[model samples]
Target: MARTGSGTGSGTLLCRRNIKLDSFLKRNTERAVYERIRTYEPCVVISETINKVYMHVVLSDERVYLTEYPPRALTIAFSFRRVRDIELVNDLPDFLSGKDRELCQHIRITYLTEKPAAKGRDWLRRDKREGLPPAAPPSRRNSHSPTIIRTSEGYPAHRVQGEGGTEEVHMLPPTRSASWPNPESLGLLKVPHPPARPPSKPPSLYSLSSSPSISPSPSDQRLNIGESAQVPRRMGSVLSRLLRRDGGSSREERQAELHLYAVSRTSRLYLHLQSSWNSYIIRSTLSLDPLYRRRCSVLSDSTPDKRLPSISLERTAHLFGQLSAELLQEEISVESLYLLLQELRTAAHRNVALRRLFWRSSEVCVFLVQTLEESLHGCQSLSGGYTADQLLLSTLIVQTLAVMFRETEVEAARHILLSAKKGALASRMLLALICDPELQTENQGSLADCELQALLADYLDAACSLLFEMLLLGQEASRCSPAENCVSIGWILRVIQPHPHLLDFLSYQAQHVVLVLSDLQESCLSPAQCVLLFQRCRLLLACLQYNSQLAQHLRSHFREEFRYSVKLSCAEEKLPLQYPISQPTLRLVEQILTLHRKLHTNTRALTSEKGL
Candidate 1:
């Protein structure tokens, strides 16, 4: 079959046909503009301590444009999610600026009903359908707007009779009212061009401003009497509907609720969120460590700069304490908290001003332990389905404790001793996590199951660092008074040794300790760090005591760890031995153990030997 007309022809009034489509678009755009003009939605307001969010109202799937004048060099388009509090209400002039209100007024013209081409419902039938336009004022509401006011100029004069038998007639003024469309005529069908972008403002505007006629009536629904009246082509322009509640459970409702939440930021929950975020920041960046002065406590007599980075620890603790209370009551956002913490930690590390946070990592760790334990006490879990982040936090905290002890060893040991019961908890959590690791470790198509290689590596590094910090810097002489650490180390090792092949678990430990001899060779070692390594060497030598020797290759392999431990331990050094522990080596080991024992027994008297 041959096609007739593709909306084009010589005798074709294509523009007239297209005009209806444009008219529909033009009407809807006006309603949208009128809606905007009448309502207001405030974006930023003080909620919690301080929070700001924006609000937006979507009208019939229209394309919006926003251009940045400064052409911000960085950001592309901003993304807005359905935030959790904000709103847009229909009180147009109430929320917008004077200029915006003026712009919105232009909408009333195009929004109302259009004039009928022919009378009767049959006008919408068949061949006329192709040339047919939007149905005329079949709906009563369309008769009230500006178009009716314009066509009224050609109508019969209003008939009136005076009390004294005198007759009078009058012509009405043009109305400036929002083009009200018949509620019934809306029919739920969407048009292409929205009432958001009114193109032309016809006439001097309707004079129906003060007393707007909103309700429908029987006389208003009648067919045109004689001369044709231009029907206002309205697109259901009911401004109040946009602002009023449409009952419940729609996507818009949810989005609006979220927006409102964002706007009203001062709730207790938001405060708690901010505090929680701060705590995470501390952990991610700052590697826990004793004070530099703690490092100097051996030579405490020599240096004297003790002023720390001015963070209010007491305040932070109080805040976290409150947060923990709220968080503990429910199965809270554990994973999100964990991720936020990680990011904050990273940020803190990159900025040195944040390093003092590390000095206070001990306090942060304590707060974390307290919060988690409290939360977990009565809080329920999904049978055996434990949280990956919770376990990660435990492991990370342990690693932090280990490093904090690097300078002042006794503090670490003291912490372990004090938290013995909790340390037990840590062990349990960590073992469980290892049972089913979380991080991705493979690059495969399905990507469903893989090792958490990166996380594993970090955990091990932390463990090794902690162990080293404890054995070396932590002794009878150091500030790491947590003696439980030394006792727990052997137990923890035995427990973990079973999974020794778990991503070079034992090898890192083995490699680090055996490399101690060369680390002892460092002449500029801090006596505490040096002796820490030396004593660690002795323990490592003990681990390798079965059938091993601290050879050059072994020493070179863990050069950094060995050097760190020895410098931290501040132990006396012996000449290099290109030999494994033969019988002679046994004697050497014996001598080293005696010195190590002296370290365990009388830590203070040997302070003079730290820098050597």
Candidate 2:
């Protein structure tokens, strides 16, 4: 019996050892599996806790994962692409304890999802059939305890830990270094060495010498030099201490530090304001107003033009499209953007002389038009009364289109007009405003009509001024080599000729051309050249006499104007009143005189025919 008992005991001991070995192998296998899976699905550990804690924070390229390992592991991954906002709240007082006390810090992340989970509803239901014990109700004692709050798929929710929690913290592998000291301790106790005792002064044999002397001595006088220098040093030291609590720093350095702090504070405030504005824009774009609407008006009371309001500039950008995109992206402010537009508009108005005004106005208008088009494209679902900025944009578009038409960019004007909501009406209004005053002689105009006329005239003057430059170039070219086949005069003549149905905008410009020629005859051209030019001018006059108004204007004013110019050139040359002209020029002059007489006679006959 003793032998049997001994064998059975040995077998029982073996069985116990085998059971323990199996358990140890199983635990090791579970750990190895975890490491293998993590290696395959690579992720960077941002932070971790090693006290058998349930929560883990991991960062991947596109998402941040927060995993809870309560009995079983479950993860909630938030993609950065869907993350709308991220905020770090530090030193938050424990709020649920019915007291305003700072308790801990937390990271608050707001993200968007296509299918959001229903609020206040648990994802998991308790299975009583599994025979699991019910979770204890949370109380004040366990408010911040490492207890499972909720469970999903048999895994517990993350336990909220505090800064004072007894958990071993670890940083990401890339950021970790063995050389770095642990930062878990709240305070460090620096061991101090004992101070050495000062030697006792020998019983003063000269008590009088130890006492401070009031009388001036040679040695004391020498020390005064050192003491005088030390006075300023003390004052400087005190001033430096007042400015900076540590080492001596100059006033400039102190000021620079202050300025740096101010700049940093300003930048932080700006970022916060921008984030809030972005949230507002997102809501506005969606036409969902959970909060009260923000009614920001960008109008300035000190605007120079009463007809147009100044847009407050809140951002700087190279292009309006870029500015608009920045505004949508919360990278720039509306005030800066609008202020730039206003300044450009003011400059354009000031320079209404055609060349400068044309380029400036075109630049401003094109920018405004592009911005408006983009805004319209993004405004499909939005519905609300237009803001001041929106109205300002609309007004700018209208003004720009008006300027385009007045400057004879009719095709561009038509294209832009067609893209607007009330394009036809705008086109008609612009046309009426720019129509020749000669065509509206009897009617007294309204204020808007008068304003329109002024705008049109300014634009026309700019257009006509461009023609002046062309004429000046032609005159210069002609003078350089009059014998060369000059096509400039021919081109201008062809372009300026009046047509019955088409409106003539170049009548005034043609008169201006004659004036330019007269100026050229006096200053830039020789007597022979002037006579040659005069001959060409006379021929041009005859061809243009088909128009009764041009014919009458030339006969009454311009013919005399050229004649006086030619006579002045003769006087300047100190020549006889009648000089022998070249055969070609002389023949041209004679033909012009003949044509003038014939045209006048035909005019009389035509008038009589009409009367009959």
What local distance difference test score does each model get? Answer: 0.29, 0.30
**Worst 10-residue lDDT window, candidate 1:** 70-79
Query: Please, what are the lDDT tens digits per residue for candidate 1 over residues 149-216?
Result: 11223432221111111111222223522232222222211233211222244311111111111111
Q: lDDT of candidate 1?
A: 0.29
Global fold similarity of model 2 (TM-score): 0.20
Candidate topping lDDT: 2
Candidate 2: C-alpha lDDT? 0.30
lDDT of 2 at 502: 18
Segments in model 2 whose C-alpha atoms lie over 4 Å from true places:
1-442, 445-455, 469-504, 509-557, 560-612
Worst 10 residues of 2 by lDDT: 254-263
Residue-level lDDT of model 2, residues 389-496, one tens digit each, is 443443444434332332121112222232234233322222222213222322339674465455544444433323332332232223222233132333333334
